[model samples]
Target: MPTSSTGSNPGYVPRAAVRRRRPAQPTRARTDLARLATRLTERDVWLTEMLHEHKVLTSHHITALAFTGHRTANRRLRELYFMGVVDSFRPLRTAGSAPEHYTLGKAGAELLAARAGVDLPATGWRKDACARIAFSPTLEHTLGINALLVRLAANDHLPLWLSERSATRLWGDWIHPDAYAHHGAAESDQLLPFFLEYDTGSYNLARLEAKLPGYAALAATTGTRTPLLIHTATARREAALRRRLAEPADRLDLPLATGNAQLADPAADSWLPLDSTGPATGRLTLSQLSTHWTNVTPALTPDTTMPTTGRPTTLPWRPIPPRPPADRT
Candidate 1:
């Protein structure tokens, strides 16, 4: 055989021959509107709408909301990322790496705008939306709210999980809750519509107490005694918050309950009603909690109110997106 490229030594390989193949170029997200539209699925649309409504969602949250497994979620999300349908960033953590938190990308906004018969700006999506959420001081707060909703959704098939933005649009004048949700018992058909206040223990106890007036106003305005569920980061915080909130909560006749955030089922017996007068008893499950506050009515239809010069409007938007259709074979 002819001498190898290594000159004299047939057994020796040239550096060029052994050089590592050029690392594959990172995939760039597609910007072609036509191509992306064709590739979109029902679930993809739902996810885009969710990102639009929720502002930010971690990979785990998205998976819990729609996907059956992490591997599948990651692969599909990677595809969406490359298609510019969703943009993501991984926050720096002191310990292990953080999961990528995703937001609506430019392409996603365009799609949503087109579907709604509105312009891109009407969708309230900006190129910097992802960056803004990624670096915001309230990122953890947002995540906490999302985490609670995700648990309710993934585990119990919660009927409604409204985002803070949507909740603000509807009730911001009275009270800007962290979120609004409806949870039902596994065995019963009764669903409890409640406003969620996810406390991270960042604010003074007085600040927590101050929120009662708005909630009272909301109840008075709508004539709906919606329960306000306060979830604290720790049991200790929950205890302190309950004590701080009890007097105001009672005086306003605001239906309030406190729970410590738990990794286990959030629907479990974790909540304690503030109206309790006696010493410690066991907590109540969300279903049991619903039974405790019989004054709380079922959620009203979205169209129950109309806007006039003097009248308030009901929540115009649906609390939850329509469930995605089953995947086609």
Candidate 2:
């Protein structure tokens, strides 16, 4: 957890794109693939409808709808455009723009034609009625987070916390991770004891700072130590993040763990992988965290949780909802 001093500062440090499995270029779905592609996976269709209804879209607007993250939303938008579902209409004046604008098109209407029946909760943790938040991402090739969750739950694999976003109360629509730990053949609890926030660099510093109080409050009330677990991917900020978290972290008496240090028992730390395999040895050892830190504060200061205000109706997300039971007439 960071102090108020970090919140008062504001400076920008650019970063290179973190490499990831680029979702296949959104292609024209036809024939077999058309049969495969039914409707826009929850959020994509909803966002297409929402943008069309709202008129235009900005990067910030995407954040409000809560479609994973900026990167995910951006990728989906590209897909929508490629599929002729929507149009980006980037101004011809410059190839790059800070906040690109978006508009709806014919394909977008088609995407939304049957969207009325799409029953994702209209208001979520932050009043974000994003459809994408509902369905789990399907993997065509390798093992994915949801697939891992299912495997762990089914005793096929151990537990792992590869969660991105969760909306818990006593805080707000904040970045709380979901815990999926498996102990032998036992079914994994849908939610883990709790997990920590990995942080570093200026961006992470600001987010971790503002988030500390919320997390602290959550722990105090729930009697759960969802400690702030920051992984310093860089060799630079590790020292500072450790120093900053050492004392205030003690205030909460939470089970704090870092990439370099394990908080006594990593299993007790709340992020145990479902199958008891743990990230490394019954613990979270993602080498893929922390690339930024020493971040000033402005980026993280907004104690606000979501694009919208108020509570989000919690619907099961980690696992897609079961198919509805058939009606017997």
Q: All candidates' lDDT scores? A: 0.71, 0.36
Q: Candidate 2, after superposition: displacement of residue 291 in Å?
A: 27
| The best candidate in terms of TM-score | 1
Q: What is candidate 1's lDDT per residue for 1-329, written digit by digit as tens?
A: 11111112323211211111223556555356677789988899888888887888777777776777877988998888877788887665433345667889888988877776666777777777877876677776787777777777766457777788777767778888888777874246567888999887888888888888998887788788889999887788888888788788878987788887542557778888888454555678887877777678643446644233442221124545523454521
- Backbone clashes per model, in order? 1, 25
lDDT of 2 by residue, 1-329 (tens): 11111111222111111112234754543213253247456555545544443334444344433443667657766776666565543222222232334555445544443333322333121112222221112111111222223322323233232234333322343345422232222232222223434332426555555555666666555454433444443435655665666666655554455542223322233232222112343344321111111111111112523343343333222322111122111
**Model 2's TM-score against the true structure:** 0.36
Model 1, CA-based lDDT: 0.71
**Model 2: lDDT of residue 289:** 16
Predicted structure with the largest lDDT when compared to the true one: 1
- Please give the distance, in angstroms, between residue 302's alpha carbon in candidate 1 and its true position after superposition: 3.2
lDDT at 183 for candidate 1? 81
Task: Give the Å shift of residue 270 in candidate 1.
Answer: 0.9
